[model samples]
Target: MALAIFDLDNTLLGGDSDHLWGEFIVEQRIVDPAVYKERNDAFFNDYLAGRLDIQIYLSFCLQPLAEHSAEQLVAWHAQFMREKIEPIMLPAARELIRKHRDAGDTLMIITATNRFITAPIARAFGIDILLATECEKADGRYTGHSTDIPCFRDGKVTRLDRWMLENSQSLDDSWFYSDSINDLPLLSLVDHPVAVDPDDKLRAHAEANGWQVLSLR
Candidate 1:
């Protein structure tokens, strides 16, 4: 079976999950709202502009996990799923996934967002294989730091390559769908690259390369 890969934020979902998680924490009073929101928004803008420092952003984003108990975080995430995530889940995206599944493709989601935020969403979509940025944990609690190279930009390619090697998979007949220009490296590597409601940069790149462009929204 061919591999069908999806980008989690914006590509499959109607909105960005990482940025929305920051907003969710702020709204929940889990962080200093004024200061946290400003930083979160700035980071998100940098991401859109292709200038994000993943380490710095992760430092800020993961700190709350270190402070909270695992149970508390799990409860918060459940609420997050009910409120923030479910609303942005696209019906068309589900149909796309179903199509791939019906065709006997192995479906996977690769995202820059931490697994803490993305795992449940992947489950919600009935997709079992997910490659996401991992958080370091100690004594069953988050250490507020990432473990390895984040699945962002070229890092996505690195992460996927490792996964493929481990699973005896390859890019042969592989399909990848993404929204941001940051995904260009991995997107370009796949046999079939689809831009899903792409941002300006990705849109231009996809158009110039004759890549398929789709919209889930």
Candidate 2:
């Protein structure tokens, strides 16, 4: 059995989703531009450092769109991601995924980007299964909150472990690619821990540990 898991942000694409989401918020006029800048700066900064709390960030991100119909918000998000980010996806990355798919490997995209944003992107590639952070729903509408599982770093390792167990698969020969050292938990859990354009922490770790480091960016 083959499992090739990929990280969504920089490994697959060249940018950060949180930064783009803030731009979307401004373009959509979902929030007062002045106020959004203040909060967005802090949120984005914390997120990069792996200190941002999912529930708080999810609440703030969804707060402005709260008044809009969920369907409309989701549609707009899908369009923005497709139009802005999808076109920028690197060909090499696509080719890598395509090769894996052709080989009949199970493709799993594991990302810190929330379900509201990443789900549609995954669906675009016919990826039905995902591991993403979810915003809570109350009466079929977003409550501007996160659910119990926060899909980042260690949480990713935990969730993937459960997935492997449920599928009766072992991590012995599976492949995983990620950029940040924050993903070390999940990376270490796999037999193949690939560092894709790794951050400094991961770069040093890969060097020290003799892990195969792939820099395609």
Which prediction has the highest lDDT against the true structure?
A: 1
Q: How high is each candidate's TM-score?
A: 0.99, 0.91
lDDT of 1 by residue, 55-159 (tens): 999999999999999999999999999999999999999999999999999999999999999999999999999999999999999999999989999999999
Error of 2 at 199 (Å): 1.6
Model 2 per-residue lDDT at 31:
78
Backbone Cα, N, C clashes tallied per candidate: 0, 0
Task: Report residue 171 deviation for candidate 2 (angstroms).
Answer: 1.1
Instruction: Write one digit per residue (lDDT tens) for candidate 2, span 1-217.
Output: 6898988887877776656877777776777888897888888878667678766787788665556678888778877877667875767788888888898888999988878877877776556678988778788787777776778888998888888899887776889988888888888878889999888888899989999998656
TM-score of 1: 0.99
**Global CA lDDT computed for model 2:** 0.80
- Badly placed stretches (over 4 Å) of model 2 are none
Q: Which stretches of candidate 1 lie over 4 Å from their true place?
A: none
**Model 1 whole-model lDDT (C-alpha atoms):** 0.96
Predicted structure 2, TM vs. truth: 0.91
